[model samples]
Target: MSEEALEYYKAAEISELQDGKVHSREVDGELICLIKLDQEIVAFTDNCTHISGPLNQGEFDGCSITCPWHGARFDVRTGKVLRGPARQDLYTYTVKVEGETILVGLPPA
Candidate 1:
């Protein structure tokens, strides 16, 4: 995992996130979803694997998120695909929260 190149960017603020919900944020012009799992913050691409559904609008029950478009389910913590129509797992980002800011690391362009 450390072999991949990454560039960390400021993704969101703590005030913009809430528990039991997913937040879609535009970081460096790319859409990413921020979620809280077991008191830790994690991030993933906002686009769902099944037909590119907007995952931020989906139902998040604190652990798993259900896609609103095709009912695909995903574990918010590991970005694992739980149920399908979506055979591919969502892409996760390395996240580090500093004070009130959330930083997400993405591959360099």
Candidate 2:
């Protein structure tokens, strides 16, 4: 489905996220990670590509997050695999901020 046709779900409020910190929220029954960098908010799958580790509990360095379980690294902005044991990239979502609300976009069901 086109991005324009994807369903946008409410994930968080602006006040709930701190700069350079990761937060977890459930959207449409799927858990996702949201990180705020400066004034931009980005979204990614909560699981690590290597061993399904929890990305929300990982270390975030503003631009990238390192999986706590296996030390795998991924770019938070694009969810691209940066370091291994993980060869597969993560699934990133389109994020939109409206007023105090943060919304994550997923493909149409």
Candidate 3:
């Protein structure tokens, strides 16, 4: 992760994130999704692997997220392709939380 990437999510609070919900946020001009599952934090690109759907509007069930535009499903934790229509996996980011702040790191672009 680059220094600029680290600075982007330096102030995210885990408490602000609701469980079983997907939150959309922009960092360094990139759309990212912050998902909370059973108190665990996960980050992934907001774009779907198929047709570039808005993943923020997608439905989530436990560890999987179904794309809103298409019927593709993806694992929020590993960004794995769980269902068809999207064979490729979404981009994932490293997440960490400290006290009231949540941090996510993306690879240097």
Candidate 4:
């Protein structure tokens, strides 16, 4: 494993997130969102790019999530901005699964 992979923090259990659902968790004081898309779990910063709205409160449509505050939308898999009042993309995190545990990679401090 690489150094980046070594920094993963346990965010959730694989069974905790159902297919086509968005789940939020706070890890080390950082709010993160986990979405199960196409049987894969993707993680992203829970804050919306527009005005720091809670992304976990947004609407998820299997492939994209829309910010509830300002109508910004992002691709769940790549964090790409799909529709925008927000120009920036969400900060995506790397996810790993070991047995039933789901780990999210955190950036170095």
Q: Which candidate is the best by TM-score?
A: 2
Candidate 1 weakest ten by summed lDDT: 1-10
Alpha carbon RMSD to native, model 2: 1.0
* Candidate 3 structure quality by residue, lDDT tens digits, 9-109: 55267777899899998877789999888878898999998999999998988899999997899989999999989999999888778887877786665
lDDT of 4 by residue, 1-109 (tens): 4545447789988878888888999977789999887668899999999999989999998689999998999997889999989999998888888999998888766
lDDT of 1 at 26: 90
Which window of 10 residues has the lowest lDDT sum in candidate 4?
1-10
lDDT of each: 0.86, 0.91, 0.85, 0.88
What global local distance difference test value does model 1 have?
A: 0.86
After superposing candidate 1, which stretches have Cα over 4 Å from the reference? 1-4
Give the lDDT of residue 70 in candidate 3.
73
lDDT of 2 by residue, 4-98 (tens): 99899999999999888889889998889998999899999999989899998999885999999999999999889999999999999998989
Top candidate by lDDT: 2
Per-residue lDDT tens digits of candidate 1, residues 16-60? 777767888898888999986656898888999999999989988
Q: Which candidate do you rate higher for lDDT, 1 or 2? A: 2
Candidate 3 local distance difference test against the native: 0.85
The regions of model 4 sitting more than 4 angstroms off are 1-6
Q: Give the higher-lDDT candidate: 1 or 4.
A: 4
Clashing pairs for model 2 are none
| Candidate 3, residue 90: how far the Cα is off, in Å | 0.9
